[model samples]
Target chain A: MAEPARGAYRELVRAQIRSQSQYRASFAMDAALTSCVSVLEILAILVLFRVTPSLGGFSVREAVLIAALCEFAFQIADLAVGNIERIAEYVRTGRMDTVLVRPLSPLGQLLAGDFPLRKAGRVVQGLALYAAALVYAGIDWTPARALLAVTAPVAAGALFAAAFVAGATVAFFWIDSGEFANAFTYGGRTFGTYPQTIYPAWMRVLFGYGFAGYQPALALLGRPDPLGTPAWVAWCTPLAAAAAWVGAVLMWRTGVRHYRSTGS
Target chain B: MPSAAACPRPGPEPESGSDFGSDTRSDTEPDSGSDKNTRSAPDARPAPIPFRDSARAFAALAGAGFRRHSTYRQATVAGVFTNIVFGIMLCAVYVDVAGASGRPGGYTTAQLVSYVWVGQGLLSVVCIWAWKELAERIRSGDVAADLLRPVDPLAAYAAADLGRAGYAVLTRLLAPLAFGLLFYSMYLPQRAVTYPMFAVSVAAATLVSFAGRYLVNLSGFWLLDIRGPISFWMLILGPLCGGYFPLRFLPEWAQWLVWCATPFPSVFQVPLDIAVERTSSGVAAATVLLQIAWAALLFQACARVQRRAVTRLVVQGG
Candidate 1:
């Protein structure tokens, strides 16, 4: 059983890679489409700088730096995962039954598909934006800062992946149409592109409100927060993501258990 | 012995119209649709009316499309929430950059704000820059049945899709248009005549976008796998078409590059510009000409290709 489980994981990964390669042109195009979307969003920030230089003490370069960070974090988080959206479909079609019958944990199977390798395109474009921020904005990037920059994307990706997994896990129970749910998953990343400082106070309070809510912002521009932010906000993006992911895992297990008992 | 020599090769044309020649994927649904909609006296059928003659049909379609869109009231509001929140943040940044007083290239901060809001909201419905399903239908050859429909295939798809697009306009599009006006204090036309003109321009944009998608989708007929074309075009033109952001915000070079390549801004920018009346009369006339030209060129090409497809199949008796 254990051997077969290992074999299945390997086979699924191999198959996914092969499938992606088979549709190389399609994969490339999807990557390019996503890259263009991110670039368009970035252009919006560029337009902001055109009329004047300073945006409340933030220069055009600085704003772009911030936008770049947001884009980077968003690309990493949003693009890296695809399988998360299939939860309802899997549940509805009894494909989940195959996972249940398998020796390996279904969570592992879910995770395997959830990580979209095609997301590499957005990730590259995002990294270019972040790099531009460093060069064009002339940031003081010491080795420590560079290492932190590396972690920023990984952390953001985890955070975004966690949000998607949580959403997918929730859909396992209701089995309702997940159409509107995309507005949450993709929309959150799109909404997060701008600095959170621009958002309304009530909206700020509703979601992350803190620097943690704006990790892409922080990892980008390190938003100058008066509420004792700089000390730990940078670390919180990954921590919050980890916590969210853990919570999502717990939820998924609960949903699975419910499925087992309900036998639906 | 060569494997080819061992077994006789099947010709491209099938022996019978009823039977789809042997194909792989033994599990997929076979015989999806009949080859022909009109078996005998095919010319007895009325020719498909040109798009110009379809005004009554167009208006009826639009009206029905509007009602169809309004049906998903909940989905509409949820979409509004995301658009408005993002609009505020984006507006804040641009306004600050525009400086203390309103005005950049003759665009006031308020006007620009409103433009961004309406432009952003209308963008979702006005331009489907990254249409995925068209390629899907073509790749799977489900378009075979779509071809047999009595009405024009592209028009039928447009009629149905336009409803959703119209819904995007009413709920998603209007929310931001109104939000920009009320909350953001956006610019409005002085004479109020521009409102109707804006409506006209917007309707034209929707149809053009639909026509553009049909052309893109028609690629699937010739190319069994259309991922290359669809993906490539989507990557290049999706953002250029004003889906993610406005072209007014793009760099001068990008603006010029995108303007000529696909007339993406004509979908969202030109209409919004008409409302503000920034375009000179000459440019406005030119813009209108370009939009019509693109719509006509793409629409005609689709018809020609579809006709050729039918002729080939019938002659080959496949």
Candidate 2:
């Protein structure tokens, strides 16, 4: 968090961007492909609506609102900290030793390393979906609702970032943990895209609260909880996000302390 | 190293890089094999290998492939866990869709549930994505060793992929399906023939999927850096092959096009339709035949492309 360390992180990101941009055509193609994947995900939701009028008691417009909010949060978090998923590789190849001996914070180095500038494509797509959903959601814009709308995705992104960081800690204990990590990191995003009531009771309690996007989305659209939870739950996203961050930070520190070199 | 254009050899054996100059200068060097006597013209290629030998080789390679996949116990467990999680999430959404509409896409609630679980099981068996072994080999110049082998690289890889699919059936395919059966009301096939037919359809689908991946990998021969194509392929295959949702959700013309003109539907949609018994027996049989046709067409393309790729093969790394 010091000024010099922050400058070092920015320089690390700038180097990655320079190397990535050197191959202009490949970078463009990757960005386009990333954008296409995001489009396909949104299309998957819309296609479900094509067959039925509503999904889990939400009309197509309302579902899109949930999906866009969840997707936007995921993309933001993914762009910010997704590279930590490569910890498994670093540990396997003994590159974690190199990462550890660096002057800056190890987590900061990992976050800044190999930053995927191309993933900005998904962020662009998410924003487009969010903008379109806002127009079609037909919400009455009070001053408070307007403020909540802007901050809601950032809170959800914070929670998702926590999920990614927490997921990366699995690499310290287990090699080849990518699949298990994806089950929650990606799975949690998919869980949040729909109304929480659709999931089984346990799934809703576990992944539903962990995602922390559905509640804010419901509040934004002015829809009552079909499961009849308290209305105050809608305002608890920031609280949930903070709690998740604290837990994730604790887990990450524990994982780093427990890390051992593969010692090839 | 001698230039390949100057030598123009008919077969893949390269004599381990010794005496490169003399080898390229001499054009009349006879091929040292029994098939040389059967050759009528000097420029003619050798006779094809006997069918029994090819089949035995295929079986051995497939066995090796199966064993290789079985070694990854941790990865298998992690993958199974992931598949079951996705299956549960997707099943919840699909149940809502099927329940809302009396029989959306002509599938009952039980049948739709069956479709979802079966599709999850088949996702790994068909292996529509996550196959980059061939491309990596190609990039690393290891594919040159494949050409030196007696068997065709296309058929050899296809057999190995079948073995991998066989392993996937036991772990990746069954675990998630059992999970679905536990929590949901799954539809049982009413007719006995559907079981055998479904098995055959799945095998054909695995072959079709392998051929598709082979073609994608072969692109590395020309493009050198195939990450772009692989990424695009991964993005499209999920939706187009019905991994995310059924292609039946598409319009009628699009469905016809997918089934007839493209090989994507034969990879996942055909086997799924057969498993759910959504189509009648006659139609189910027809879909299996369609899968076979696609597999044959794709493998033929793989063979031709492999032949071409090897002749112009430029190994990237030493």
Candidate 3:
């Protein structure tokens, strides 16, 4: 069962790549533009830090690492489930009916179909920023710390992917819930970039403990929480990410069950 | 007169109506009264070359745009909610940065809160993401009909965008301001003239923004797929326009670069400064003047681009 699903996914991705390759120039231009935009977004934070070296008690370099980590995770998740952003359109246009009839799960098919190679540009940029952050942040690279660095983004990516799925699930009810979901998915990405202590108490609780991107980021950075959370809490990123993903999948299943075809 | 020349294809054989074919066909034939109420047909009668008539036409388009955008009640509500949420988040960030200093980058906590709220409110008003309509029209060749219309396409689109801005101010703007005012210690300008100045500055900034967006969408004529250009514009505009942070916080050299090289500060930052009373009256006046100047320059540029685009379309048999 897994092998067939993996084969199907591979074929879907390959087909998309082949079609996209025909418009190589257009694709390259779009990818370059996206990367430039990502770089500039990082530049905004860097420029801000020029005036004040510290934000929420983290140095500029440390803050950049957090941002880079968030961006890295977001890019990976976006590359995987970015098509979830189009779930509203699918629901409205009755495309969901077509996906529902397939042997594969709608969510899996959507993820496979929308896997974007263009986002590799952003991922590369994230890596560069992450490297710079590591150099400037002056971390002692113990074996455990290095392991945390390697695993943090994957865990963070899983959480972000879960957020995307949850957002898409909302489309089963409200076709225009994209913006509402953005309050979580994009909002979470932005929230994770900053030290969690900077937010209001409610936001810190909602994003840090409830959503779980912040603790993971802090953990990966080997920094204790500015809000004075336990140091051991950082290690819980993978567990938190797994829990969120499971919750999101359950929500998605409920949404699918409730979904009615638009009859287009 | 150009429309006349463009229309005089031999016999009443409809201009090869592949692009915008549905629109022209529906215009010639009466509506079937389907559930989707197609817009009223364009006047087949030739337009007179009078200034008053042009003004009336512009007003009609603007009014239609205002009404059309207001119908998205859900989007408007969601937009307000998003604005409030982000506003609160950013306000907290700015407040935290202020730390014990109580004034990061020369802005008091109250002023920073007000700036975040006002910035969120004016965001849609200034940095419009609605240029997709123009780009889509261009790509679909629907702009052929638009070009053949008597009024200038640039003015028509600009006027319509101004209407959208007006509607946004009514629906999307007030809620964020109210939210910020109720929750945060927002800074209000003390001077009696400050309110009026800010209002005028905002209106001018809207025009500047519209003109810039219109030019960006015009790239669709050349690029065919304008996603790249649009993304590029947003990337450049967001930071320079102070969407992310107040331009005043940037280094002096960066401020100089923005002031001298780009009209971006006029779009969001200047109006924001006026509202926060960061700018002296003299500087506020200068900024407003600069915004108007940019609008005028951009509008002229749009006209030039439209001329070239139309020529290209005509030559290419669009």
Candidate 4:
């Protein structure tokens, strides 16, 4: 059963890629535009840093590294569950009935359908920014640090994807809850780009504890918090991510059980 | 009824109620005079009698748009909450960045707070998100009917959008500003001239923004899918219009580029400067004039492009 499900997911992705390739011009334009937008955001940070040498005691290079890691994790998570945004559309158009009748889990089916190749632009941009930050930040880059760098974004991506799933789950009750979800999903991405110390204590507590992106960003940067957090806390990213994922899965199951299908 | 018969049907129902002209006919149905004039003779229709006919038409369409958008109360409330959340986050960043510098980029902490909050309030007003309704209508062949209408499509759209902006100001704008005022030490403009100048600038900015988006949506006539251009516009315009940060924070050379190249700065940044007293009254007055100039220029450009597009549609028998 697992093998067949994996095969079906792979086939779905393959078919989507093939269809997307036919619109190469549109795809290239979209990808370039996405990258351009990401670059503009980085430019805003550079402008800010021009006036001030440090943001919350982190050097400009460290700040950029934090932003890149946050963006890298965000783009990866976006690629995974970006289709969740369409759940509201599905509900509105009564297409949820089709998914309910399918043998596969509705969440699994959604994950397989509509793979967003366009987001590759953001991932590529994030990688480039990450490399630049790594070179400039003058990190010691020990084996452990290098290993942490590689794993941190993946963990952060899982947590962010969980945020997406949790947000999508709310669509079962309110079809137009994208903004509410965005307050966490996109909001988390924005918050993660900055050092958590810059925020008010209450904000730091809310985002840092409620969302998992903050820990992983600090872990990737190998930086202790300006707010007096212990260095060992950086290593807790994976645990935080796992906890978030488990919670997201349970919430999704409840949402699925409670979903009264909209008629076709 | 010949022109009505000739008008092509929009293919398939649009998925969302946001689509333009979806309920436009029904809203305009009670105004029997204009409906008779439009249906009776397309070519023989008299020149528009300016204020009487067009004014009434504009008011009716604007009222419908205002009422239609007001119905989305839940979306408005959610948007307000999101804005306040982001507002607090942004205020924190600005405060942190201004630490000990007193006034980075010549803006005091209070001024910076006011800038962010005002920018938030004005965001939906100068929204750069290309209204995709026109583009979708063009793709679905619904624009054929739009083109045959006795009224100029550009004017009609501008009127409807003005109504939408009015509604947004009441629902979306005040909450964020009030939130900022409550939490932060926001700077209010002290000069007497600032209030009227800011009002004029905002109205002109809305019209200018509508014209820019109108041109973008009109591209759907040529490009079957316009998502690429729309995304590009939002990305470029949002920062240029100072939605992200005060344009003054940018280097002088970049500021010059914004001033010379685009009317974008007039959209949000100008009104914001007036509100924060960042500009002298002379400069504020000049900025308002610039917004009016952009509005007139862009509205004319929209009319010209629309004429060309409609002619192409007619020639191609769309």
Between candidates 1 and 4, the one scoring higher on DockQ is 4
Question: Could you give candidate 1's per-residue lDDT for residues B66-178 as a string of tens digits?
Answer: 56556546546645655665566557655765664356656777666766676667655764444545556555555565565445556655765676677787677888778
How far does residue B55 in candidate 1 sit from its true spot (Å)? 7.5
* Number of the candidate with higher lDDT, 3 or 4: 4
Candidate 2 lDDT by residue in tens digits, A78-195: 8999778888878777899999998888898998887989888888888787878888888888887788788888889888889889988988987766777777778788788787
* Model 2 vs. true fold: TM: 0.89
**Model 2, B1-318: lDDT tens per residue?**
000000111111111121211222222123245344445564454436545546666777777667767866777787777777777887788888887877777888888788878886787788766466677777778778777666677877787788889999999889988998888889989999999999999999999888888898898787655666766766666777777677887778877877777788788888888888899999999988988998898888988998888887887654
Clashing pairs in 4: none
Per-residue lDDT over B77-122 for candidate 3, one digit per residue giving the tens place of the 0 to 100 score: 7667767767777877788777744566788888888988888788
Once fitted onto the true fold, the runs of candidate 4 whose alpha carbons sit more than 4 angstroms away are A18-25, A209-223, B1-45, B314-318
Best by DockQ: 4
DockQ, in order, for the candidates? Answer: 0.26, 0.35, 0.31, 0.37
Q: Model 4, range A133-213, lDDT digits (tens) per residue?
A: 778777776788888778877877887888889878887777656666766777777777776777878787666532344
Instruction: By TM-score, rank the candidates, best first.
Output: 4, 2, 3, 1
CAPRI verdict (incorrect, acceptable, medium, high) for model 2: acceptable
Worst 10 residues of 2 chain A by lDDT: A205-214
Which pairs of residues have clashing backbones in candidate 1?
A: none
Model 3: CA > 4 A from native: A2-5, A18-26, A209-213, A220-222, B1-48, B100-102, B128-130, B314-318
Count of steric clashes across candidates, in order: 0, 0, 0, 0
lDDT of 3: 0.72
What is the RMSD, in Å, between candidate 3 and the native fold over all Cα? 8.5
Candidate 3, residues A1-264: lDDT per residue as tens digits?
589988998898888777665545557677887776446656767766766768888777777777777777777787778667777777877888989999997887887787777777887887777667767777778888888888888888888888889878887887766666766776677677676767778777676432344565666567767677788888877888888889999999999999899865
Error of 3 at A183 (Å): 1.2
Q: What local lDDT does model 2 show for residue B279?
A: 90
The numbered model that scores best in TM-score is 4
